[model samples]
Every structure is written in structure tokens, then in C-alpha cells.
Target: MPRVFLSFRKVDSRWMRDRVYQGLIGRFGAGEVFKSGESIPAGADFAEILRRQAAECELMLVLIGPAWLEARGDDGMRLIDRADDWVRVEIETALKAGNRVVPVLLGDATMLPEASALPHEIAHLARLQFLRVPETHLAEELERLCAAVADLMPDIGHGSASPTAPAAPAAEPTVTMTAQVSGGGSAYQAAGDQTIRLA
Candidate 1:
């Protein structure tokens, strides 16, 4: 079964995030999905906890809005430029761990900027395929998303790698030959796609 990770700048897309989380939890079950504030307990080392949890998830849904890239740090620079930005860190961890990442464009958000415009750790976001799920048709989009995830994480119900069958084993062929002497009877044999000519 695949564990779900929801990544986003909360302030930039709170409504969309909340709705998406609800839809996913409904489809994937409560304990199967993960969100920062919703799932994380109040404790020391909260940042470290998020980092570790994000890395362990099997699939990640990144909700992006227009302001996600525009968000600025207290220093007035883009948050993405900061090494410790939680969103950036979360994305980088998922990428390095080979988790399936789905970029969800919310509201009017468009394609992400090129690698040169993003932090080195998360530049790969530019290349990841993104889906645009309109706010009005969230349910319909989620239905489609559910179908896709079903194929992507077929182990959900079975608690295994996937629901597909294992490949069949193959066998090697064996060969035998019989030759006739002067007074002995002749024998004949035929093999698939193989022809023998006699002089």
C-alpha cells in the first residue's frame, strides 16, 4: 500500500489543500494519508519530524498556487531561495527517495518555472508532469485521480508491492538425436521452426 504525502505552502493555497486532503483521505483512508499540521503531533523537533515523514511516504501530492513561488521570507527573498524552507525541503526529500510526485495546480496556477528559476535541490519540479484540477470540478478530478492512483499503487488493498500477477517462469529446450546404421530402422523427429535436409 502507498502512503500519501500532501505538500504545499499552506498560506498560499489553504482552501485547495484542505479540500484535496479531504478527497484523498476519503478515497485512500484516514491513516493512509499524511499532511503536515493535520497529522503531525505537537512536539520538539517538529521540522525534523516532517523531513523524515516526507521521505518515507510512497506518493506525494504537491498543491501549488500562484503565490507559492511568490512567497517571501522575512528577509524579503523568495522562500524557495532559502535552504530550510519546509516546502522545498519536503519536495527535495521526496524526489531523492524516488517517491511518486504529482504536482497539482490549484486555482489559476500555471506551469512551474524552469530549473534555473528554482532552487537546486528542487529544480526537478520543473520537469515533473503536473495536473490542473479545477476548484469547481474537484470531485470529478479526484475520481480520475483515484483511478490513476489505483493503477499507480495497486498494493493498497493487498499489502504488497502491486496487485498484478507475477511473471510466468520460462523453460529451456532440450535436444535429442538418433542415427540409423546399415540394417537398423530410420527414425524421424521434427522441431518447431527447424528443418533438416538429408543428402
Candidate 2:
């Protein structure tokens, strides 16, 4: 399965983030998608975890909101100040690791400024490929995003056949067991005796 790193301004798009996370989980299964608040453990070293996730991810999806350009960190520092800031670090590491960096424009955000106009650490983001989400069809737009993610990881269950089939007298229940490790360090395994793991 290919890992994906999700980068966004938390305060600016919390609802959108949750929706995107749920959509990705529905398409790619839970383990392959990583978000800062949900994928990283509470007390873990954030910078290190972000770096590790970025290095392992096959793609990085940046959710750009209206305020994203002016977002600031908890310490009142601009997000572009340090390379270790979540968005900056993830994009930088993804680029260095040779992974695809996709900038998704959510809402009615304008084009990103030129690299020379951006802060040093995040200037490279200006050159990445960008996709814009339509204002009305949020779910449909998310589906498109999921499709893009699926394109990168064809085997990770984005379009895999469901284990269950319509009820038929001669058909047996084809149950599949999948294990998922949550960001909080919880292991979730399918609850069934005759479960076959998906390849």
C-alpha cells in the first residue's frame, strides 16, 4: 500500500480535513492515509514524526484554504518560518524523497504567489502541480481527490471489489480480515473467524 501525507492548516479547514480523511479512508482503507492530528500520537515528537511520514509517503496532498497563505503557528510564527513546520516540512521532505507533491486548492483560493514572493522554506511549493475543488460539490470533489490518490497506489483497495456480495442462496459470505494501526497506537483487526486478508 502506498502511504499518503495530508498537509493543511488545522484552524482554517478542520471540517474539510475531517471530511477528506473520511473520504480517503473510505477509498484507500485506513492505514494508508496519514494526517497530523489523527495519524501522529499525542506525545510523539511532532517534527520527527512529520519527517518520517513524509519520507514514507508516496504522495503529499496539500489542502489549500483561503487563510493558508497567512496561517501562523501556535507560537505566533508564520508557518513558512521554519522548514520543520508541518506543511513546509512535509512538502520539502516529499520533494526530497522523490514523491509527488499535489497542492489541492479548497474553496475559492487564488493562485499561489511566485517562489520569490514566498518565504524561503516553502518557496518551492509555488511550483508544484495544483488542483482546485469546486465550491458546490464537496463530496464529488473529494471523490476526485481519492481517485488521484488511488492512481498512485493501485493495490491499496481504492477500487478493489468489496468482500461481500448480494445475498444468494448458493453464495457463501466472503469475509476479509484487515488489520489497521491507528495513529493513537491502537490495532484494529476485522472481527470474524473466516476472514481472508486482501492482498
Candidate 3:
């Protein structure tokens, strides 16, 4: 299971979300961070997996971009107002699970909507202290966020390499093979640098 869950409206914050994912992965390793797009397996149940991850994760970062609050659906209604909205469900699940939920304001986003503007289940998000990642200070802000997460989750170690760094080549294993000719045929045995005797 992932240690951190990233919650965001794709239409509103895909770019910023991707950046934040990269930053967190760089600091916490890819296996420790969960973003829906890369974390979910193909042909799997979406809602079930999302809720399970949100509830099980140790930390949930809610990425709120400039258009997050105003993002509308087909009928011009705000997406967050819908109970079935993926972002809302993720936040609500995390909150209900009592996981550490951090609001990340991206780009020009300065604040969250009023409590009355959000659903009852997620209204507390409006009152939480949020982290601001301005366009000009993304890298620094991301580092700060990583430090904060590390402080909150002592089990997660900070990776020295970036998320896109290539993995080192695996060392080749050494094997020893022995063939014994008995009464009828031959028997062969292989082990890791170990000789086997057939009797």
C-alpha cells in the first residue's frame, strides 16, 4: 500500500498534480506515493480502489488549482457539489478514516472555498492550514512539502534519486552445474555456487 495519496480534479489540476506527484516520488520513492492514474491497475474497479487507497493511506494531499472550485460538470453545476465526484469522495474517505489530509494550493490558488460552499462531509477542508505552491516557487515549495511529509511519516525514507532516475543494472547471479552419470542415465543439478553430490 502507498504511504501518500494524491487527490485532485484532473480537469483542474492535472499539470500541477503531475508535478506534485513527481516531487513526492522523488523524495518518498514511487512505491510509497499513490496517484490514481499510475497507481490504479488496468481494468480494475475504479471507485473501490480509490476509496480503499484514500482510507488506507497515511497522508492525502488535496491539490487545489485555480479552477478547482469553479470546475463545472455537464449541466454547469460545480463538480464538488455532486456526492459522486471522485475528488470529493477521495477527500471525504480520507477524512473519515482520520488520515492526515493536507490541502495543497497550486499556481495562483490562494485559499479554499467557504465551508458553506462545500459538502458537509468535506467542509472541514476549508479550515485546514494549506500549503501554497506558487508558479515561481514550485521546486522550493515541493521540497518543503516533502520535508513536512517526512516529518509526519517517520516510516518513509527520503530517496536520494529523482523519480525519473534510471535503476541500476541488476548483478548477475553465479550458478554451479553438476552432472552425474549413474546406472542408466545422467542427472544434472544446479545451485548458486554450490556443488551437489548424487549417490
lDDT of 1 by residue, 1-199 (tens): 2387889896787877787778776666767777877777777577877788788988888888888888997789999888888999999999999988888888754566678989988888889888776777778977776666678788553443324467887754555444444556575576864455543
- What is residue 64's positional error in candidate 1, in angstroms? 0.8
lDDT (Cα, tens digit) per residue for candidate 3, span 75-125: 999999998999999999999999999898888645777899888999999
The Cα error of candidate 3 at residue 100, in Å, is 1.1
lDDT of 2 by residue, 88-189 (tens): 777777878888788888775556656886767667788987877656789899898787767766766633432334576675676766655556776446
Per-candidate RMSD vs. true structure? 12.1, 16.8, 10.1
Positional deviation of residue 19's Cα in model 1 after best superposition, in angstroms: 0.4
Task: Give per-residue lDDT, candidate 1, residue 87.
Answer: 90
**10 residues in a row with least lDDT, candidate 3:** 157-166
The TM-score leader among the candidates is 3
Full ranking by TM-score: 3, 1, 2
After superposition, candidate 1 runs with Cα above 4 Å error: 157-199
The lowest-lDDT stretch of 10 consecutive residues in candidate 2 is: 157-166
The TM-score of predicted model 2 comes to: 0.71
| TM-score of every prediction relative to native | 0.73, 0.71, 0.77
- lDDT score for residue 59 of model 3: 89
lDDT of 2: 0.74
